[model samples]
Target: MRNWESFLRGLLISLVALVGCWLVAGPTAHAATSAPQTPTSPPTSILGINLTGGFTQQPIDSNVISGHSVTLSAKGTRNILETATNPLGSRKYVWWESTDGGSTYQQVGTNSTTYTFTAPEVTKDTPLMFQCEYDFTGLGLFYNEWSRIATVTVTPDRVPTTDIQVSADSNTLYNGESTTVHATLTPDNATDPVTWTSSNPSLASVDAYGNVTAANTSSTMDGTANDHGTVTITGTSNGRSDSTKITVGALQNVTVNEGSDATFTLNNLPDGMTVANWYKVDDGTTTALNSTASSYTVSKTTVGGDNGTAYYATLNYTVNGSTKTVNTNAALLTVNKSGLLSLTAVPNFNFGSTDVASVSQDNTTLENLDEATSGSNYDGNDNGELSVMDSRETGGDWTLTASLSPFALSDGDTGQLSAVILDLYDPTARLDENIPATNTATKIYTSSDYDGQTFDVTDSQLSFAADPKITAGDYQSTVTWTLSVAPS
Candidate 1:
């Protein structure tokens, strides 16, 4: 009987130790093993009392971008029936965050139904963990447990600016004109601020805000070069930049006389162009010219030939790995000249003096009638003694005729001589057309054939037969010449 009594006492002590172990480690934050324990089950029954239920709304897993904030919320409900019967405790809520997959936790928020936190700058390899805990310590029966663990995922979104495009409201500006610059950034969410600059401040100036103003007309900022010069406006951000060209002045039309060279220029042309191309617009037709110069000239212009002509240039450039093209304003050209058709120079023939004539006398050598040739000659020829010019703008017709009178004795000795011929040797030698020359009228040249040019004729002589009963004392003859229109 003594041995049985000692064994029963040892068994009772062992049972008390088993009950103490259950109270040491409470339920998991989620009641990890199963549902909350009841009043009869001491280890999991909300500190052995039932005044409130577990969280009705716990923190849910969420995703957020870097540099942005996210809100977390949780709520617990009271067992009104149980709480009214025993209003013993007020609960306190606390939030916690764990970085190491829930290995340990640190308090981040307390006594709040909601918590807001910012996302990290870079995404983490593993998701972050968060939880909410409730405590009812003031009441005689204390309750302790935590809400289910929630996860937060973060990702980076504020990327650096990769490209920037800049433009101007007015690409072409006059002196004293103002314009604004606009810029666009790639990826839209970039955080870098754009800086503004000007390539040539003398032609144009810009402010930090991208506002631009053109140089004044009278300004000698760059020794009169800025008055009509090109300038570039650029915007840079995050090591990326883009530029736009602004033409300071517009193109102008010019007027010039015909038969002269005319020059057309584009003032204030921007740089970085790829071998500009010039185009001429004539009679409603646009054709490409061989010229590539910004200041181009049309050589030896004709009267009204290029009147009302317009020219323009295509400017191609590169910016930020992109190619772009622009055209300068059209410039017009006008040519003016008057029409004229009048004789310029004429040739006079001189026959060498002879005392007496025998059978036949001929003068072959021809002398031009200039200041030193015996008389004043109005019109002259380049290769000969005869010269004619037609400065008319269009085509015209003209004729030259000649006649001879009989030779007579100079001393009035009642002597006469005949059979004299004045041959105009190779009249077409220097004239425009190959027309035969005779004593009668003949068509020489027309403005259409030799416009804005001269007509010259040479090689004329006199051939005469001596009179048998000749009483020669010095002989003379008269030759008549006439220039008439329409070949009359």
Candidate 2:
């Protein structure tokens, strides 16, 4: 009995200990029997995004001469779960460009899936680099690694580098003339057009198609003398050029009277002319004049030799260190013979009522009777001019004289009015030579057209001066005109 009772007490103590353990461990066992749960993927990582679909390698320019342009595109596929709430932020792409072999970078595109790039003017082999970046902004604004770099090769335009030469049809041209010029390039395949220019536009001008026209150094009309010079023409093409030279010549003519000085001139003497000579050709003999200037003159006494004598001029010049000579056209000379001398006087000049300190004039009519003969030896026309005619057999230059008697009024008062001076003008004098103070036998007119012809002194004028104390009645004066031959 004592042993059984001890075993029972031990059993009781063990049971009590088992119940206390069950209360503590029952919740732990229940927690372990629940359904299995899936492992978490760390909130679908938004970082480490990837970009694709752009130029993976360098592209060569095909149309280099004109220019080149292309479109570049990129896409973001991974880490795009945030695109539904923020489409722009999740799939955003940025483009970057590098022109100096990636030494520097520049942002070229943003907030888009694609981009376009245009190259600047490239004169040589040029390289360009491009890349793209993907962004995920939903979770702390994350960015993906940059895309693989893309390269592009651009070519440049072509330039000309050949030589050009030019030539003209004529190296020498006269004023108011033109010639055509031509140009030649070394390479026959060159397509560049040639341009022309003149060193002296006043001396010569050139047109676009290479037509060269001669111009005058001085500002003169086309058909006048003294219109000439020299000029240089140049042609250019493709940065290359050449030049040529041309010369222009001058021309002229002259004439003179029998007993007057005759002069000849080289109208437009060209440059480099060292000397000039004048020559007279008579009866097949050439005589050199004593003058070496551009102009030569012959005296009146030496010019009355023949009716038709030829005179010419020659110019000496240096061309490329060599002496050269050029001749001008011949000019003709004329001489005439001496004839008779005569004159006619106009009627008395009468002044009507004249006041003191007043002036008046009267014209007379005078005609040369010898000048009325038909078929005369004179070279002047019958223009009714006041003239002196020389018809003497031993004829020479002649002159006409006028003697004006003192003016007297009808009242016969010899006062200051009577001493009034008379002046006359031969309106038809050869060189506007006039006669003044007609109180003495003053020479009036002279003529060298020695012929038995008539000349009219109808333009003669007589004047009267009135003093304060002189008479105021009608006054009259007589003018006596006479002619005499001039000594040779």
Candidate 3:
């Protein structure tokens, strides 16, 4: 019986030790399985938990088109709950949209890890941004997730009204001359590109690539001149477009005149153009053209030798891809090789002011008038000598003094005298009185009276003129007398 008791006591002690070991081992294993997972290190305590997540942001430009949207996403990372059995207790996600480029955030979505935002309207040259946040909480621990702010830009796709510009705002072309009509498209915003086109194909045509060509139209077209036509050009860029109209014409009336060079200039011409003269005539000798332009003169060497008249040539120009002509007024000039005496008068007389003086007299004639053999000769055929004099102030009564010093004055020896006054003070000054004892006073002079007549000489008088209210300090005009000899 005593031996049985001893064995029972030993067995009981062994059973107690085994139960203690089992309890401790079970608890240790459970703790290992339940602990939070950390990539860097083991958790110091199971009670403490830490979680981390990530968010991604995509910029959805606030200025994008109506159908466009921006996206933002949150990704889970460094999850404290490693196993499905140990999941977080709660999850929260928030998304925000910012119209002011993320300056201020407004809630757009909640309770989601990802969000997509779309803009309603966009302004030109504006910026936009968006952002989101995620939170995870379980077992008395907090996890945070954030997304980088997404950014986008807003811009207008439509173009505003714009003005059309030309590379050469003005152009000039002669008959049969061709030039490019360079038109440029301009947008209200300098940053935008432009498109160009033309309206009137008959008068002028323009290509999409900004090339201008010429067209033909009869005098029958309405709103167009008998010899001229108009072309319309349209320019568009973005959503805006504009049109411009230009006129085209022909050199209807061209003529030959006496000029320094063989060149002639067109009158009433289109912008940015010059006149070119072409003369084809069979002169006894070959004809040479003048050096100066705007008008043409027969070559002094060829004028008298040719019996028949030379006709002026036509002028042509291309504007905006179409041809236009410049009309020149007809001017008939004849060169006489015979030596003759002629006269021309240069008058500088003031009817309003009492200060009157005769610059020249009637016997101012030129001798030996003939066609010019040399260009430098002043008194040659087409050229005449110029004799000038100052106003003769001989008291209140002005007298025209003329002298035939070297030659006798004959009935047919005609001459002209002109007077010019310097510094005409008041162009509006009235005639003080007629001078000299005659039925009707032949001469009028400047008025000293303040209560004199006023005249409108804005277009007629020179720029250096005082108001009608005359001042004593202001001087009258300087007297300049000129003499010109005409072909006898």
Candidate 4:
């Protein structure tokens, strides 16, 4: 009873003392107005990168030969390249290389919009990882947080490509244009190499690969009456050689717009040579047209096949009373790309203000373009975008072509940039982004490509040098962008 009484007395004394102190301290320091707490923003960028999915296209997986280098590219999600308000496309690219299969990365490149890396020094079985990032340093905004990990695998060099054979997509190559000389090697895994060389380089030239391009000239080739003559292209591998006879001439592929009447005809045929029959080849099957006339016309309604459906004729000629058959070169059929296809946008190339530069400048470049804005004219810090929309209403292989018109002076002056050419290279296109398996083509300049879908050439490398000694004035030119339907 005594202990309880003492505890109660002590508690009563403590409460009385606390009340006395609070009365003296004027509301116990909890009184008076407190300042409002302003909320701070989360973040606009992380380490100079907008991590909210800022990249539209990133580098993909690639397989390269042992000694070759692979270029990994990334495109930002922005519509335009650069502006006063936008520091996104200021061309600050850093490439990270991961040799241990993307576990850790090391900095490798700080070059242009694209980054390149040579082959790995280690075993190439594991795929290497590369990610391109845009670093803005002290700038408040960021362009790309990180890019898609571009996986690269280096293939074995070669087992010595033995036993090779060569063939051509077209027996006759048109001047200034090109045709692929498809080469087939035995053993499938044989990788030595098949070197292609032209006997008459003046008539035609063959590249390291088997692409044969004839010389461009208004004059007929070979001094033959029909503008047809053969150039020997030999492919050699391991002491074995296969020769392909490609007739170099001015045989333009037949283009039929919107299934219009396309007459399969040849001009300037020899007097003694007569056409035996016109063969329509489809899917490795051949059928005779049965008409022995010099030409055959395909009706508009009959043009239901794919573009580049071949129509070739066999000529029957008497050599010393023995009738022999010789097949003439193939003429590829093409349907017109009108309503079925359209070139929705073409971003003009602006070389910007330049001092008279004749020192051979391939360094001229344009920033990457993602979505093309309407009337989007890209200056030196420009966006050169080429877009094609294929509706699949009707058409052939959807092809988009661009040509540079002559430089016309803004002051109504007449002269030439003269041999100064602005070449657009390294254009990329995806047939359908919705379909992940569809191919992404890098060569969109003049190839028979794309169909039944829409896509954009996000970035095209544009470059040239102005004549150093030329007159100084503001000069402008228009790029002629054309759309056609041809088969691949």
Candidate 5:
């Protein structure tokens, strides 16, 4: 019984050993059917895209920058969506880029990688695109697509401008004269055209091409001879515009009277000037008229005078083109009436006389020499006195005379008479103190018959030469005196 039991135990041990060996071997060929299944379709698929969400063309992004845009990025897509998984290997992703918008595509990179592309031209019509995919064939073939489309835009550059000029034929415009002006408009950019406009059409007019014409219209320009108008021209081009202005006028009218009324028209005068007009009236009328000439004559008309018949005149002028007028401005003229003054005279007047030159000899010699004894009485001396002869006074036309009359002078002794007029009216008068000879007085003569000589005096009375011819008449002259003496 012991031998049989040992044999059976050995067999049981061999069976256990065989089972352990089989369990130690690798999976069977059919083990794959019992493995966990891998998905055939990807969890996410790309349907559309957003060019700029967080993606940007700018290199930095702490804060948004101006004048820049974000680059293309995908929209409605999940970056973490599941792709087919392989038991032994990691899944890889692929990406593509396109320059012509999204018309066509090309492979750019592989594996789960970010795709970068050369920036497209920034223009209004430029196009660009991007796409991505994953290869999951190890477990199950699948793809997660992401894409974006875009266009480039370009900015603009420009500005506006204008030009102005003026011209006239003459510096001076008459009251009835006119002139023309030309203005040319040039723009900075030829492509951006300009339109022309004016401010005052009444004062002046400008054509479409900028030709200006001056119209004879009334104006209120300060300091202008005549009120006139002004013109403003504007040029517009692109998005901007500019303007300029001009003034017009003529010389003002010259005035004659202060309170006179008259409307006078002038022609052919310089512009922006002020002057006065000459005015005059004819005898027998109160109406005054302005002369086209610079000077004018006055007639007996308009003057408020009696039947005596007299004439008056006036001139007109303007100052700084002002309205103030000077009445009957008689700047240059004189009126005379006859017999306005009278005259008188006084004559002889005993002008004091002085002793002419004289020489006396003493003949009182003791007649008989005392030695001869007889004492004779003989003594003689000549006593002479000279006096002014007469005094005459007259009121109506009278005359005063001065002369050198010689009398009792030695006939052949050769004597002269010189009378120095000391005083003509009063003999005892203080002549030098009261009246003196004037350098400007006209001289009168002592002759009766009025002679051509208004004055005459003896050259040398001592020599008894010719007596000065004297006369008196309507002596129209200043006061005068003479020096005279007679030789004895």
Candidate 6:
């Protein structure tokens, strides 16, 4: 009996300890599995913006002029976590303009990279400023800083309103000459077209474009006399008119000796005559010469052609409230030739430095100073003759040869250039005669038959051809010319 009681007491103590432990662990596990987890914050967002592209604050003077249109552009860029992304879908742009410095602003444009606006006209100089604002609407709506200010100036259009004046490019003109007249309006924006008129259409005529042409006249032929007349030109604009007078005068006569310098003078010129001009006329072709004074000296070349070559002089002067361009009579030039054959030296030809794979040519002309005669007419049998003999006394019909020597350029390198050739043209044959690369004296020119009379001949055009492969340094060659009797 004593052993059974001891066993029951031990079993009871063990059951109580097991029950306590089970109760504590069940509640702790339940609390852990059923409780709500701590809520996490949403992913942070990083937004960035900028104003770029063609945005600049330039000087007012450098901008477009008034009454003109200008375009302003702005570029917007966005990034997420410092990485570039498209901002077009989430952003908008607004452009503003300020005409009064920065005191006030007006919305000029929006939602575009470019805005075209016409500059307003002003009485005085004005400044215009433009800026752009970017609006961000993604995630949350926000605004970006204003873009750089672009400034320009609008200059006033000063149209002529009063004291309208008219002027002319030239106040005087000779017969068959023209002058241009222009009107000055008070304001630059004046739209009135100027009407032009001539006091005497028989003396001078005015065109719609303000061009005035002097009429033809038959005047005196004395060496110092001129036919003088006046014509008034009027320019009318906005019911206002201005008039200018133009004077016309006759030409005088002059005489000169052949192969001698001749002086042409306009004596008894009208008062206020300050400018003088001289011209040479040959075969209906006119050539202007440098002669500012009342007198001009004719050169030997000018008096070397035919015996009856003529020249004229024009005097610019103001007379009786009018400006006039009066012409002098035809100045007859007499050329006296001793019937001798003469030649003028030709200038040296320089091809200049060239690179490889290129071709170069030099054109030179030879002049014949002999006078033209019946026998030696331009197209006659005894026209003219030219012959070349080798300097080394090479006999017979000689030929011209070319030899290119090796040269050193500025780089201190030496090389030989080749394929050099010479070309001569025959006026009678109307063909080109090319000289071969051989050392022979060539007769470049020879008449078909020789006549006793020597006449002025046309120029001979000589050309030298050089191959690009020739060394770059300065290369020189010698050509010898000798005059010989014509071959029978």
Best by TM-score: 6
lDDT of 5 by residue, 207-262 (tens): 54344444442322122212243456666654456666654333232332211222
Candidate 1 weakest ten by summed lDDT: 39-48
Q: Which residue ranges in model 2 land beyond 4 Å of their true spot?
A: 1-251, 301-306, 334-488
Worst 10 residues of 5 by lDDT: 55-64
Rank ordering of all candidates by TM-score, starting from the highest: 6, 1, 4, 2, 3, 5
Model 6, span 1-488: residue lDDT tens: 77898898888899888767644543121111111122121111111111122211211112334677666555544423212333333656667777667666677677886677787776676777766655454432232435556565566653334545777665655454455566666554354456789888776787755656665533433222222346788888778888888764333234443334666555544344554678777666677787777766665432325445556676665433456565555554554433323232322333334444443343222232234432111232223443221212222332222232222243446653454444544455453455433445655454322211122223433233464345445544433444454332
Task: Tell me the tens digit of each residue's lDDT in model 3 across 1-66.
Answer: 999999999999998898676445431211111111221221111101122123212212122343
Q: How many backbone clashes does candidate 2 have?
A: 12
Supply candidate 3's per-residue lDDT for 275: 48
Residues forming the 10-long window of minimal summed lDDT in candidate 3: 41-50
Output the lDDT of residue 218, model 4.
Answer: 35
Q: Give the Cα RMSD of candidate 6.
A: 32.7
- Greater lDDT among 4 and 6 belongs to 4
lDDT of 2 at 70: 53
Per lDDT, what order, best first? 1, 4, 2, 6, 3, 5
C-alpha-based local distance difference test score of model 5: 0.30
How far out, in Å, is residue 97 in model 4?
Answer: 12
lDDT of 5 at 476: 16
Error of 2 at 222 (Å): 28
Per lDDT, the best of the predicted structures is: 1
Better of 4 and 5 by TM-score: 4
